[model samples]
Every structure is written in C-alpha cells, then in structure tokens.
Target chain A: MRLAVTGAGAVGRSVVELAGEYGHEVVAVADSSSAVVADAGLDPEALVTRKAEAGVVGDGDPGDALAADYDVLVEATPTTLGDAEPGFSHVRTALERDRHAVLANKGPVAERYADLRALARDGDGDVRFEATVGGAIPAISTVEDVEPGHVTAVRGVLNGTANFILTRMAAEGLDYDHVLAEAQDLGVAEADPSFDVDGTDAALKCVILANVLSFGAADDPADAREFTLDDADVEGIRDVPGSALRLAAEDGRTVRLIGEATGGTVRVAPRLVPENGTLAVSGTQNIVQIETSHAGRLNISGLGAGGPETASAVLSDVGRLG
Target chain B: MSDAPDGAPEDPEGADEADPAVDGGHDPGSSTHTVRLELVDEPGQLLAALQPIADNGGNLLSIYHERGNKTPRGRIPVEVDFEATADRFEVIVGALRDEGIAVMQAGTERYAEELTLLLVGHLIDTDLSDTLSRIEADASTSVADVSLAAPQGTAEASSARLRLEARTGETADALETVRGIAEEKGLRVVAPLAGVET
Candidate 1:
C-alpha cells in the first residue's frame, strides 16, 4: 500500500513508523512544517532527525503535498471544532482525490459528521475513524461487529488524564494541583489542558461514539449536554461522609463516565456502576465496556491516549482498507 | 405640630412615590459572560466552587462537567457561564477561589493564541507517545492531530506529519518546547513551507 500522511506530530510519526514496519510504502508526509516527498520512500529514523534540526510545532498545511496515486490518506492533525479550514480541507481533499481516509482527528467528525459521512457514501472510498474515539481499544470496530441487537451501552475511562487524576486523588490522596503538576511532568496531560479537563475532548469523543452507535443521525453535535466536574463542589464531598466513596459508589456499584444514546436522549456523564461492574475496575487505563442487549458487558482496555497506540489503530484501519 | 418640626413637610405620598433615580437604575442590554474553569479531580468539588457564584448573584447558565475528563494534573475542566454585573463578576471569581475551584479562563475572550507546527521522523520506533507528551508538557500545547504513514513495518523507518495546536502568542515557546523534545528523542522538526493562520 502506498500511503500519504498529513500532520507529522507524535501520532502521525508513529503511523509512519508502524506502517513501514508492516511493509507499507510511505510515499508522502505533510505537516505545518515542510512536506517531504520521497520517490524511494523516506527513512523514518532520518526524518525524525531532520525535524529535530528544524524547530517545528503545531499545525499548518502539509508541506511535501500528496501524490495523486497514493492508496490511503491517514488524517491525524490537531482537532479544532467549528473551524473546519485545515483539517476539513485536508480530509476533503484526500477523499476527493479518491484515497481511503483513516481519521485520528476528532474535529472533522465531531463538527462535520454528516457531511463527511455523506462524502464517503457518495465516493467510491471508505473512511474509518476508530482512532478518533479510543486510541487502541477498538471500541468502534467492536461496535460495528456486534449483532445489531446485542449491544446496549458504551462506557469507560474514555479520558486518561481525568482517570489518572481521580486515581491519584483516590489512592495517593494528592491535592488537585500537585497531582496535575505530576501528570504534566509525566506526560499524561497537555499544557493548555482545558480540552481534557473541561469536557470538550470527551464530548467530542462522545459525539463520535454517538455517530458510530447511532448509525448517522442528522443532528448537530452541540445538542449533546457537556458537563465538566469543574463546577462540582469537591470540599462538599469531604463534608459528606464517604462522599468520595459514594460518588464512586452507586446502586451498590462504582462509577464511570457513561455515554448512552439509546432511544434518542444522548447522555454523557459520571454514573455509578456496581463494584463488580467491568468499568469500575477499568482503572487509569483506557477501557471501553460495551453492553449489548445480548452480549451483556464486554470490556476492552489498553493504552488509550498515547501516540504509538493511536498510530497502531490507524495502521489496523489501513490494513482493513488494503 | 411640635413633632413635625424642621426638615420635611410630611406628605404621605413621599414614601409611596417611586424615586426617579431608582426607577432608571437597571439596564437590560448588558451582555452575558461565560468563564471556563479547570478543576482538579476530587469528590464533591463542584458544589464548593458554585457557592461563590450563587452568593455573588451570578445566574448560572451552564456547567460543562467533565468528570471523566482530566487535566495534565489529573483534574477536570469545567466551563461556567453566568449573568451578572461586571463588578460582581470579579467578586464571583474571587469567591470561587475562596471556595477552591481553579480558574483556567474567566472569560471567553481567549488570552491564548493557537499555533500549528509539523514534525517529521521515525515516530513509532522512537516512541512517538513520549515525544508528543514531552512537547505538550513543555509548551502547554495539545496534540490536536497527527497523520502518519509507513508502507513498511515498524522496524522500517517511516515519517509522520503532525498538527499541533498550541497557545496563542506562544508559538515560539511551543516550537522551542518541540525542539527540545525532538533533540532528546532524535526527531526532526519540519518547518512550515507554507504558513497559514490556524
């Protein structure tokens, strides 16, 4: 397979390396920085060295540009909702050029789910965004494979940074600031950190999940209720004896942020699960527990937010496309 | 007559009449404001934070409660909007801190700008996850998007293109942060060939 990658950040780089390892030919690589096109395929190791030499960061149009003949387009650019100029433009261009698109960016899907899905439907190509929801958990693919009547609800630790913080708070008794600083130091959180902490990132993922599970509702993503724990009273919990435990415990069950869109009302929030529940034990790792009407609850867990993990998911999608 | 003495002719209508100054006091055209707050993960955290806003006469618009989402510090991010006087807004924010909710941004007007950059290298073999984490940690930037391709397997070196969204006016700082990570991990930073605003 001849592949073209847009965006040369962590996940993009991982896709290149992994695809190369899987015996695919990486033909073109693009980023905000210079795009590199190689006829004989570029060496990943050397490319990394070159990027280091140049001081590059953030997003821009692909530098090297895409070849008309590439078999697949792996879209892994930064996510920005409402503003569809770069990511939307890039994906649309790839699809227009007849390349199979494997999207890791949530912005395009969250903001333009209908338009992009329609484009895929109209074109003689396939578009997969499993990496958009869970980095390596295969949540989307699992849902796709289930017997239509078997699956019920999808829930888990969709966001790793939040889970990590909660875990630290629960086990280590660390203050929020101290734990967050440690998370930053450990590469578990971003510098701006608002997206992860504020619920937008999770909301975007929920939107993607809703699309996958709902099978294309012609509704706006903004309609979903997005609530972050920011406004919740933490001190009040301490005052309420066992409030932490109670918050984590419900109906004699532990809790997790569960996103359910069954029967129309799409809800995403922290809900209590039984202690014996699969999601309760999901821990800091990224886990997706899909409860089908028949299959009951099936849990999938792994490194959910890392670049390499996301790249691997993209590779899997590419393989399927091939 | 003696008790009615000096300053006023006691008209019973004086107390019943509405003061002209008081009648014209309220304005309906004031714009509503929203604040984005980042909170650390803990039990019963949000309630304490809301006390100040409620006490200070801030009308609650919406609370984006991302309990499942965590910040780099393992905290949750929350966005709250309210209608209040500008002077009262400050009091609400102060009261929130007094109750202990970390304010990430008080207003929607972004103090941070966005910059996009590209990275090229053997991202997989070199542990692209670590590389991304490092850059994000340094510049307080987020991994917005990443596109990668390797026709070959993991052992074979391949290149990836990354799209990063960093803080506004912090592009230079973000780039420096990426540079440090690239150097440490032996990755290449591909300077933008064509520049465009994010």
Candidate 2:
C-alpha cells in the first residue's frame, strides 16, 4: 500500500522508516507545521534527518499530505479529546478519497466513533485501529477474530507508566510521588504525567475498545452504542499510598491500573490483582485479557507504548488493508 | 460449590420437610446444610464445635475456617457445611449452641462469596467504624477482616484493607454499598476485579 503519514511524532517517524521493510511506500508525510509529497516514494532517512535538523518534515503545507495520492492514510497524530481535531479531519480526507485509514490516534475512534464509522460506510474505505488500544498487543484484532458478539469483555493493564509506578511502589515500598519521580527519570513517564497517572490514557484505550466491542457486536451499525472518554468511570493511581500496596502485598496481591470494556460500558481504575498473575505485568509491560462466551479467555501482553512498538501495530493495520 | 453462601440448596430442605414428596430435589430426607459459627480462637474449639454436628447424625461436607477473620467480639468465624435430615439439623444447631458455640447464623443464612479491597484517605477522620457498620448493615454483606495502616498517625491519610464476605452473587451489591460509603467519606477504594480469579 502507498501510505500518507501525518503527525511527525515517534509513531509517525517509525511508520515512515519501517514502511519499506513492511513492503509499503510512504508517498507523503507531515508534521504539525510542514509536509512533503512525492508520487514516487519519499526517502525515509531524509525525512527523519530533516525533522531532526530542521524540526519540520518539509516545506509543503501540512494539508498537502492529506491531498497526496495514497492507498492508506496512517493517522499517527498525538491524540486529542472532544472533537478529536486535525487527526479526525485527516482520516476523513483519506476515506473521502476512497482510501483506507489506519489510526494510531485514539481520539477519532474513541470520541468521534460514530462519525468516523459513518464516513467509512459512505466511502469505499475501511477503518482499522489496532494501535489505539494496546500498542503492540493485538487486542482489537483478536477480538475481531473471536467475533465481537462472542466476546463478553476485554480488559488489561493498558498503560505502561501507571503500571511501572505501581510495580515499583509495591517492590520498593515507596509512595506515589517517589516512584513517579523515578518513572520520569527513566523516561517511562512524561514530564507532565497527569494523563498517564490520572488514568485518562488508559481510559481512552478502553473507550476505544468499548467502541469496537459495541460496534462490532451490533448487527446493524446504527444500533451500536458509541463510547467516548466521558462515558468512562475512571480513577487514577495518584491517591494510592504505599500502605495500600503494602496491604495488597501481604495478601499476595498488588495494584495495577486496569481498564475494562464490555459491550455496554468502559471503566479504568487501580485494581488489586494477584502479584504473580498475568494482568500484573511488571515494569512497563501491558496485558490484554479478553473473555469470550465460547472460546474462553484470551490474554495478550507486551510493550504498550514506544515509537516502534506502536508503529508496528500501525503497519500491521496497513497489512490488513491489503 | 465454593460460593454456596447462605446454603441456598439447604433452604429447600426446610421447605421439603413439610412436603418431602413435592420437592424430590435431594434424597428423601437428606439435604445439605451450612451453619455459620463463631468459635473462640482456641486449639480445640473447631473440633469441639464439629462434634455436635457429627453427634447429631449430620455428615460433614466441607469446613471453611476463617481463622484470620474475627467477629466483633474477637471470635473466629467458621462456616461448616454438612448433609443432614431436617430433624437432625435442628438438633445440631441446639447442640452447637449448648456447647457454648455462638452460632452466628444457621441453616439458610450463610455468606458464599469473599472480596477484599483497599480504602485510602482520612479513614479515621471519617469514622471508619461507621463506614464498616454501614457495610455490615447491608443485608448481603459482613465485614470479614480489616488491617489498618496509619503510617503518619490518624490525622493524616491512612489505608485500610477490608475483607468482606457477601452472600452468593451479591458481591457487586456489596461493592456498591462500600463505594457509596467511601464516596461520602472521601476515601479512595481500590476494589478487586470482580469475577476474575487468578
């Protein structure tokens, strides 16, 4: 597939760089300020180096990439809430031109799911967002394979930063502040870790999962329930003290920010789980556990974030479009 | 079953006594019975309590001894399941009580499910005892065990791990009750993932 990539973040860069190995060509690429377009494939090394040296992908308008000729639009922009801005508009442009769209941004799928679906239905393109939920974990695809109607629930430790802090707090008997500081130092958490620590990031992932489950299970797309971040009942790990982890540890358990999505609801909270259990993935690892009606329970765990890790999921979605 | 709290299957035994032929669910005169007992946390207390059921022609089924959990009076809570005729069940209850064993609940009123959760915040300032009693006051739940950690004294934030025993299939209700109480108290509840066992 010929891909037009947007948002020059880690995911977007990796998707551009690795598209060749995945047997695809990146015809267009864009960051916030600039874009580059070439009918004949763009050079991955030149793009990456240009972004590093000049802080921009090219001299073309960012909207030029949206109009670029491509078979798939890889929407890898930083996720935004509410209207799900420029990312949603980027995907809409692709589908409007009858090109498939693979999203690394959670905004379009999570907040404006119904609108995205409406666009996909009217156009010849199909939408797939495996990366929007569990990074490298094939959560959405596995649920698709099981057939969403047969899957009862999908849940997991979706966030790495929250899991890392909780794991360290339990292991070292430290409070949230100390472990969060350690996480920031290790680059596991961002400078303003409110979204990761406050459970918004995980909630967004579950909201996306809930959208998938709801839409996938409905016989008619019109009958499905659309979920957004506001529909989630989220609780962060910021308030969890060392004493709570201590109490859980005494009972052979620990805490993790677990996100769950059923066909009807989405919830993210710091839940007590068995210390050695599958969901209690240590460090920055993530786990997705799907409960099905006939096939029993399915668990998928791996690195939930990082440029290449998430980019790999985006590439896989492109492969599926083939 | 592990979650047969309040001995659901045993309740029919009582109704069956009036019309054994109508029920025909179990053996003509034999059915399972679960008795909740408060035994003194002592070496021979369990054996002494069980002897009554066996002495009264009740065949032991299973014993769930919660030694770590205690009643308000500090007595260990034990749940004993057994198969007995309707007539023998009455005798077993009488015999256990006569032996000074506090039969907290007998026959059909047993808790079948257990859940543990952590509450963090100003637990002491919010009247933790009232929070617990409110949870207990809910017909479907009882406070099984609690371990409190107040590292910075009672005035500051503290944590308490509460183990609750809820009637069969009422774990969600029990959690809702606790959540309501915790919300009013400004406490954060780290609840266990329901229906997900390791």
How do all models score by TM-score?
A: 0.55, 0.85
Off by over 4 Å in 1: A56-64, A147-150, A216-255, A261-263, A274-276, B1-198
The positional error of residue B194 in candidate 2, measured at the CA in angstroms, is: 1.0
lDDT of 1 by residue, B23-132 (tens): 22143322245766666576777877777887887767668888787753366778886666657776886677565465555654322433333344466788888887
Please give, for residues A1-322, the per-residue lDDT of candidate 2 as tens digits: 9999999999999999999999999999999999999999999999999999999999999999999989999999999999999899999999999999999999999899999999999999999999888899999999999999999999999999999999999999998999988889999999999999999999999999899899999999999999999999999988899999999988778899999999998999999898888889999999999999999898989999989999999999999987
TM-score of the second chain, each candidate in turn, equals 0.43, 0.58
TM-score of chain A of 2: 0.99
| Alpha carbon lDDT of each predicted model | 0.62, 0.89
| Candidate 1 per-residue lDDT over residues A177-284, each given as its tens digit | 676788889888787666765556666676667666555322443443322222121111111112233323322333344444332334444433444545554435
In Å, residue A28's CA in model 1 sits off its true spot by 0.8
Worst 10 residues of 1 chain A by lDDT: A232-241
